[model samples]
Structure formats: C-alpha cells, structure tokens
Target: MDLELYQVDAFADTVFSGNPAAVIPLYEWLSDDLMQNIAMENNLSETAFFVRKGEYFELRWFTPESEVDLCGHATLASAHVLYEHLDYDDPVVVFETKSGRLFVDRENGFYSMDFPAWPFHEIQVTERVAAALGARPDKLYMGHRDMMAVFENEAQVRELKPDFRLVAKVDGLCIICTAPGLDYDFVSRFFTPDVSIPEDPVTGSAHCMLVPYWAKRLGKSQLTAFQASARGGVLKCEDLGDRVKLSGQAVTYMKGMIVL
Candidate 1:
C-alpha cells in the first residue's frame, strides 16, 4: 500500500522552527497496531491520522510509543494539510476526536483551534518534583491531563534540566513548566517521558491548562503564550469559560509517499 504523508511545522512561519508532525489522510481506518508502528517509524513527536466522514472527520494522534487523547501541533498540521494540499474548501474543519469534537478555523493565514479546557486544581509540590525539574516551583497544579509547575520567570522555564526518569515518576500524563513571559503574557515547556515525548517543541494542548490559569491570574480573557523549547512557538490564547482558543501559523515542510 502507498500512503500519502505530509510533514508540517506547526506554529511556525518557516520550516524547522516549530514542532513537526506527520499527517496521513486516510479513506478508511487502519489497525491501531499499524498506526502505532507508523508513528514509531516516523520518529517524530506525534503523527496524526484522519478519515473523512461526511461533513466531519475522525482524527487520532499517536506518539512514538503510544496513542494520546489529545494533541495540538498534530491537529494543526492535519488542518494545514487539508487547507493547503487536500483541497478542503470548508472554512472550518470539524474533527471528532477522543477528546470530543474539535474545530479548526482558518482566517488570514492563521488557524485557530477550539479545544475543551482541562480543569486544574492546586497541588502540593513534593521533593521528588523539585529534584525532577531541578528547580523549586512557586506553585503547582494538577490538571485532568497533566501537572503544571509554575515558576517565577521565563528563565526558570527555559533553563530547566529535567531528569526525565524522575519526571515520569511524579504523576499525570506529563509535566508542564511555565512562568511569566518577557514579551508575551506567559511561557511554558512540556515534558512527557511517561508517554514517550521527552520534550515537545510547541504544545497546543498544554495551553488548555495554561490559558485558564494565566487568565485568572492576570485578569485577562485573551493572552499570548510562548513555549520556550529549543524550537519555540508562539500562540494567541483566549479563555472562553469552558473552552480555549489556540491560534498559530503552520508551514508545510515536506510531502512524500509512504510505501508499506
């Protein structure tokens, strides 16, 4: 079988500046094992697969090791493929996903994703957490999907030297390190050793928890975010009661065929 594959750089205007995700458009569902193997072969942060279903699409995301409930960069890459290469005429692409229905809207070269907010509550910071992250957090919160470590400044988020093994031992799906940004409203970095992603370049889903927290703290409904990974990303964020809007740009890196 020959499968069409597109690699897109999410949240970046130029190539190699953002998170890269492999997107595969399918007419029928592939076996879970096959998808997982494909994701592993791609050896990227995440691989996105989607199938058209009338007016909507069914979407799924897989990491190198396992499937995840939600992913922001891959979703953005999928939408980019639809708009730029697949001749998707709709202004909005609605996807039925494990996290529920997600909508990606395109306007003026930017794609905005509407995602459900993951609820977060205060959590105690333990010694293991401090040792794992190599810095003492000012505050900690446990979200439905991940655990957040709030720091005092952007330097703390950027200079983190985490012991991935220890981070995996703490709790939750991943560890999110965040702080007030220098130019933007806030900054963050995501690490998910447990789920196989040691560090994600630009994580859209992490903002689901970050937006609400920053909005409540800063007294603003709309905010800007910067993920301080090696290959960084910029995101326009809005807190909408129970939902979050994440907007960014994407550029196609490459297009090729995968033969199996």
Candidate 2:
C-alpha cells in the first residue's frame, strides 16, 4: 500500500521553527500497532492520523512511544494538510477525537483551533516535584495528563532545566512550567518524556490550562503566549466561556509517500 504523508510545522509561519507533526490521511483506520510503528518511524513529537467518517473526520494522535488523548500542534498540522494539500476548500474542518469534537478554522494566514478547557486545580507542591524541577514552584496544580507549575517570571521559565527521568516517575502526561511574559501574556514549556517527547516546541493542549489561568490572573479574555522550547512558537489565545481558541500559523515542510 502507498500512503500519502505531509510534514507540517505548526504554530509557526515558517518551516524549521515550530513543532513538526506528520499528518497522514487514510481511507480507513489503520491498526493500533501499525499506527504506532508509523509514529515511531516519523520520530516527531506527534503523528496525526485521520479518516473521513460521515461529515466529520475521526482523528487520532500518537507519539514515538504511545498514543495520547489530546494534542494541539498535530491537530493544527492535520488541518493544514487537509486544507493546503488535500485541497479542502471549507474554511472550517470538524474532527471527532477521543476527547470529543474539535473544530479548526482558517482565516487570514492563521489557523484557529477550538479546544475544550481543561482547567486544573491547585495542589501542594511535593518534594519530588521540587527536586525534579531543580527549584520550588510558587504554586502547583494537577490536571488530567500533567502537573502545572507557576513560576515567578518568564526568565525562570526559560531557564528551567528539569530532570526528565525523574519527571517521568511523577505521573501524568508531562509537567508545564509557566510564567508571565514580558512581551506576551505568558510563556511556557512542556516536558513529557513519558509520552516519548523530551520537550515539545509548541503545545496547543498546554494552552487549554494557560488560557483560563491567565484570563483569571490578567483579567483578559484574549492573550498571547510563547513556548520557550528551542524551536519555539507563538500562539494567540482566547478564553471562551466553555472552550478556548488557540490560533497560530503553519507551514508545509515536506510531503512524500510511505510504502508498506
């Protein structure tokens, strides 16, 4: 079989800047093991697979090692492939995912993703977390897949060096370190060795927690966010009552065929 694949750099206007995701559109769903092997072969942070199901496409995400419940950059990258490569004309694309229905819209030069708000609750910082992070957090919270840590400022967020092996033992998807940004509303970094990504350059799901948190803190509905990973990415965020809107640009880096 021959499979078409698209490589997209999400949350970036240019290639080689934002997080890269492999988007594979299939006629039918591949087996779990095969999808895992594809993702492992791609070796990106996440590989997105989608198939048409009625009016909406059913989407799934996998890392190099395992599958994940939610992923932002890959979702955006998939939408990009549908619109730019597959010649999808619609401005809005809806996807049925494990979490639920997700909507992506294209406007101007940016792609906006409507994702659910996954607000976390505050928690007491444990010594294990403190040790792994190499510093104590001012505040901490727990969410479905990761722990949230609030830092003093963006400088601290940029300077953080966590022990990934130790962090893998703490549980959840990964740890999020965030602080108020000097230029943007906030800055963040995502670490998830458990999912086989040591660090994600730009994370859309992480903003689900950040949008609401900063909205309450900064008292604004719309905000800007920067991920401090080596590749880096910038996101425009909006806090809807029940959901959050994450907007960013994506560029096509490569396209080819996978023969099996």
Task: Specify the highest-TM-score model's number.
Answer: 1
- Give Cα-based local distance difference scores for all models: 0.95, 0.93
Cα deviation at 136, candidate 1, in Å, is 0.5
TM-score of model 2 vs. true structure: 0.98
| Candidate 1 weakest ten by summed lDDT | 191-200
Query: How big is the positional error of residue 99 in model 2, measured in Å on the Cα after superposition?
Result: 0.9
Regions of candidate 2 where Cα sits further than 4 Å from its true position: none
lDDT of 1 by residue, 213-241 (tens): 99999999999999999899999999998
- Name the lDDT value of residue 18 in candidate 2: 95
Q: Estimate each model's TM-score.
A: 0.99, 0.98
Model 2 Cα lDDT, one tens digit per residue, 168-208: 88857789999999999999999888878888999999988
lDDT for model 1 comes to 0.95
Candidate 2: C-alpha lDDT = 0.93
